[model samples]
Target: MTATVAAPAIRVQGLVKSYGDLRVLRGVDFDVARGSVFALLGSNGAGKTTVVRILSTLLRSDAGTATVDGFDVAARPGEVRESISLTGQFAAVDEILTGRENLVLVARLRHLPDPGVVADDLLERFRLTDAAERRVATYSGGMRRRLDIAMSLIGDPPVIFLDEPTTGLDPQARLDVWAGIRALAERGTTVLLTTQYLDEAEQLADRIAILHGGRIIADGTLAELKRLLPPATVEYVEKQPSLEDVFLAIVGTDPDSEPADVITLEEQR
Candidate 1:
């Protein structure tokens, strides 16, 4: 007997979206494997955010089929919603509530048993125990980002969407967020991330897709994408030979010689 593999955690087939006369997505197709990180890359208004909102069931696609955790996002949105969590570009925690209270509030809203225990555990897990009693407004940017991510785990959904989770964080703080994201995938959670940071995507994504002009212009492992473009060696040597050195190395500025502007990284399969 042949064993059957489960469907991808996220699957979108011929997805098309539009607003009146403007098309935002153009028949896009992609799949994300179970328990892996998938990164979406694009510049401003490239339809990257639209994809996340659609998959998270926050918006409806004008035309196409999308499924999350085996549930149809359009027909069975509730099931899709229940199976996923999203930490958007901005932290959505309540400012009036204490860090602990905010978590407990989320836990309670999820109808979990003994929210206190879950709240306390997440606080410790995210290293927020020391500030548990502090109002969320008082937390620093990085701390709030951590707490935002921790809040998304209240029910431990199998899939999570992190939309530029480390956008404005400093280097060390960004690393902390990356560590937390890694931990989630290690625990068997499927993660879908959207970011402009090549390093972050290189470190976390199992696969990547780059969006441009409201469509996916490139998709593949880093090496594969790099192969699509020509390679160049930029060498440096002592010198007044400055112009001569650069001219010898790069030759001419044929735009095609440059790497694709929108680059996202993914692990090689």
Candidate 2:
């Protein structure tokens, strides 16, 4: 008997887009499996964002086809929008509103019943219950990002498109966002993430697609893609803690540090 394979939650084939004389996407194709994190990794100007914009129905592709939840993005734009939520590079949050109020606002916008209850539940889920009443302007970058992601969950859309979710965040804030993303996949939400940071993709994606010059040059699981490189030769090198290590040990920082201390300590070496 032949085994049947499940269809991807999102699919794209021969997708092409251009801005006047510039072609941002050239025959891009990929698949995002259900309940998985699929990362589109590339550097700046590699058309990662363009692909995202097209898939989310915010922009039309010049050619090819894309489907979300089996609904054609071009032919059925309404249904495509219904099946997905998009979070852009920077958090699109209202700075004046309290975190709790932001969640309630989104829930109400989606016309969900018991909006307050929904907001309360999400605040607890994202570990923002304590900061819920504080204005977003006063919250840390990580807190704002967490609340931003929390707001996107109001309607429980099946697929989420996160465009460089941690772009400007500090290390700790990035880690916090990473944890939230893991939680989303664990709960069966399909996440499509686009980022330029290799480590970010390494840390988050279940499968990765390397986009270069407007095309997918590589696509596979982390292990599968790594195998494309030349075989590694074993080498043993002494492991030593650098000055940054000692500095962190003396005073916790790198995230919050004294520039004077950094210069003084490193200069001594």
Candidate 3:
């Protein structure tokens, strides 16, 4: 007996997209294995969002093909939509509504049998139960982002697209979102994330593709990408005291002088 290979959750081949004469994606090719996180890394205007839009069926490509969960994005848009959820750079929650209301709204829109039940379940899952009744306006950035992702899961889609999910978040808030993303993959969901932060991709993605010049210049795991570069080289420089040290020394030598205001390293930058 022969074993069968599972189809990839996402597959793109020769995918091309353009607006007027400005081409975005150029022959980009990659595959995201089922039940794993695949990150697309690129600078602004490098076509990361274009790829997500194409895969989510929000935009049609000029040439080539993309499939999500075995459904063609262009040819079977409804089927593709049924299998995927998208959370773009900005959180889509209604500010006036409470977190619970937001989730219930999505569940109702999806025509779930019991919207309240689904909403409560997701609130528990995302650890938003305590804040479920609080207006989203009062939630922190991380809370709102978690609720945004929770809303996307209303229909339990097999694939999720998160475009710059942690953009503008503080370090702790970013880590919270990262934990949520990992939990999704742990439950067998396929995640495709686009991010500008290299460390975000390094910490979350099972595989990564670097987009440059409207094309995927590199694609592989972090280790694989590292292997593509020259071998590591390390050099150490002798320690030198900063301006703070010099100021402290001067102050100690001359107690008669008034103390200077403390300056942070960031202020120097």
Q: Per-residue CA lDDT of candidate 3, range 1-269, in tens?
A: 99999999999999998899998888999999999999999998899998999999999999999999999999999999999999999999999999999988889888899999999998988878988999999998988999999999888899999999999986656867898999999999999999999999999999999999888899999999999989989989899997646655645533235777776789888
Considering every candidate listed, which one attains the maximal TM-score? 2
* TM-score, every prediction: 0.83, 0.90, 0.86
lDDT of 2 by residue, 209-250 (tens): 999988999999999998999999999999998764664566
Error in Å for residue 200 of model 3: 0.3
> What TM-score does model 3 achieve against the real structure?
0.86
* TM-score sort, best first: 2, 3, 1
Q: Over the stretch 199-223, how does candidate 1's per-residue lDDT look in tens digits?
A: 8888888888898777778888777
Whichever of 1 and 3 has more TM-score, that candidate is 3
Arranged by lDDT, best first: 3, 2, 1
Better of 1 and 3 by lDDT: 3
Q: Which ten-residue region of model 3 has the weakest summed lDDT? A: 248-257
Task: Give residue 80's lDDT in candidate 3 (0 to 100).
Answer: 95
At residue 160, candidate 1 shows an lDDT of 96
